[model samples]
Target: MAVRAVRGAVQVDRDDPDVIFDETCSLVLEVIRRNDLALDDIISIFFTMTPDLASGFPAAAARAVGLTDVPMLCATEIGVPNSMERVVRLLAHIQTDRPPAMVEHVYLRGAVKLRPDLVRERRPGTRGPGGSTATG
Candidate 1:
């Protein structure tokens, strides 16, 4: 057994809780499915939002999606000059046999433009943003 980590990032269009919740839920599900992860295998999930998105905790979206058993935390992303705005990033620590190099770090939506290398390098098996389609 080994420890693996995968990170995925996307931007929120609005600060409203409903929009934030829907987007975050969809994003989390995509990452998990892309990495072929089990909910129980997740050690924890950390979410960070840009300062502009301050309607509520993004972690709440995880709970709403029934990930209550998984430890979740929320924070604010550093405000760098000319950085993408209203972005929500997620870092998930998982227990698996795969190495970190094999893990896919996802960057989607507006964030995808921030890291084209990552987006382009992502495996075709990895799912993009959506319900359960594995097509990143």
Candidate 2:
């Protein structure tokens, strides 16, 4: 199997720990589901949150999603002027047979603006940007 890296990001409405955990878990599960990956296939995951997100570590959400044995790390994103706020990003390395182009990267909530070209069309039951109704 070839090793590949998948990227994902989620924007939270606030810096609440519960919001962070829910959004982070949603983002992680989307990446795994889209890429058809299992926990054993994951080599490691690195998470970085924007300076404004201080409620908790994104890695904690990964653990909540049952990634107990995966090597995970969390850090603060470099504060660039005018960058997005309350954003949590992840880089997950996994072993997969899919080609790089076939590997999916997920960007949810307002984070979709970070990489519009990579963003998947919102699913029927999925939340839209900023976690609002897609049609409204």
Candidate 3:
């Protein structure tokens, strides 16, 4: 098995703890699912949130999702002028046979805008502006 790093990020609606937990969980799960990873395969996860986000640590959301024994760390991203706000990013190290090129990096919500080259088409049934169904 080869060690690989998976990346993901989510844009939270606000600095509320609940929103951070929900979005962080969603982002973490998607990264795991897309990479066909088992929790046991994870080595560690490092999470960083934009300076504007102070509601809670993103690692707490991973714990809430049953990552009890995993080594996780959370920190504040370096403040960059005109950077995106309310963004939480994760870099997960895992053991996998898949080649690095095959790994799917998840960028959900407005975070997709951060990595247009890596963004896949939005899944169906996703909500769009004003709560309408998002369609390609």
For model 3, give the 10-residue run with minimal summed lDDT.
126-135
Candidate lDDT scores, in order, read 0.79, 0.88, 0.85
Put down candidate 2 lDDT per residue, 1-136, tens digits, no spaces.
9999999899899999999999899988878887888889999999999999898888998998889999999999999999999999999999999999888888887898999998655557655445554452
Task: List the candidates' TM-scores in order.
Answer: 0.85, 0.89, 0.88
lDDT of 3 at 18: 93
Q: Clash number for every model?
A: 0, 0, 0
lDDT of 1 by residue, 18-126 (tens): 8888888877877776677778878899999998898978789888877889998999999898888988899888888777776767776777776776664434664
Report the C-alpha displacement of residue 98, candidate 3, in angstroms: 0.6
Local error of candidate 1 at 49, Å?
A: 0.4
lDDT tens digits, residue span 3-104, model 3: 999888888899999999998988888787777888898899999999999989899999888888999999999999999999999999999999988887
TM-score of 2: 0.89
Clashing pairs in 2: none
List candidate 1 segments past 4 Å from native: 120-136
